[model samples]
Target: MIHGSVVHDPTGSWDTKAPLDRDAHTALATAVLHWDQHTAPAPAPADVEQTALLLSGYLDRLARELHAALETLPHGQLPVRDHVAAEIALSQVRRWLDGPSGAFQGEPLAQAQSAARLVDTLHHAVDRTLGAHPPTAT
Candidate 1:
């Protein structure tokens, strides 16, 4: 009798579908919360610094993942708007990460908050863009 292959790999080559790392997601929430001006008992300097570092690392990783996805997709598969949005979001994160003590200068928390928002935006934009181009049937 004919039989299917031993296993199915429904994902990127060696990458599969890389979900946002749990630690990064948690850092995102923490960064956003601590950076909020309304949050009582403001975060300590170390907390803010740590969050910023995590955010920077996540931004770097997320941007690369998004780029790989875009590169691998078939041309014209993703909507123009969605593609542009993802690019813009990526730019937002990349710009911040690249800048050494950007405009937020004396405000790392503010920077971290911005990074969190940018990363979140990039994450959603990539999801939307990729979702536009669903995987082909096996």
Candidate 2:
């Protein structure tokens, strides 16, 4: 069943709750599966440019949220090693955004790549902070 199902609650009490970590993992996995099935290659230049503008705004919001989450980690609780790993991942993300790989690609490709890198960084940080496995390689 999907994470939220009316049938699961027969009592009609609408007692819904947000997903916990495991549920989140499952949902993300399902989403990736669906995306893989449905997504096609990058679109034409006009569409790409329009999409890029929107994607850039979304990425900015995501970056802010990531920064906030990073701040919430307890000082001693966040291991130096994990921080270093996150730093490395973030650097890779930046490189992807700034390097030659970003130049020739259509705007859609560029945007998608940028978003993927951010997701990678986010996953790494979340795994490190929660002491959980790096989420099942979606």
Best by lDDT: 1
lDDT of each: 0.71, 0.49
Query: What digit string (tens of lDDT, one per residue) describes model 1 on residues 1-138?
Result: 998564554552443355668565756655475555565655787877777777776677778778878888788988888888888887777777666766346676776677677766777876886676667799
Error of 2 at 112 (Å): 3.5
Q: Give TM-scores for every candidate, taking all chains together and pairing residue i with residue i.
A: 0.72, 0.43
Model 1 stretches with alpha carbons more than 4 Å out: 1-19, 22-27, 34-39, 100-104, 136-138
For candidate 1, the TM-score is 0.72
Cα shift from native, residue 21, model 2 (Å): 16
Instruction: Output the TM-score of candidate 2.
Output: 0.43
What overall lDDT, based on C-alpha atoms, would model 2 receive against the true structure?
0.49
Cα lDDT tens digits, model 2, 1-138, are 569443655542342232234344334333333333136644465655554444443333344344555676667666688877766665654554466766236545455445544554656565675562223465
- Segments in model 2 whose C-alpha atoms lie over 4 Å from true places: 1-41, 89-108, 130-138
- Residue 88 C-alpha lDDT in model 1: 89
What is the number of backbone collisions in each predicted candidate, taken in the order shown?
Answer: 1, 0
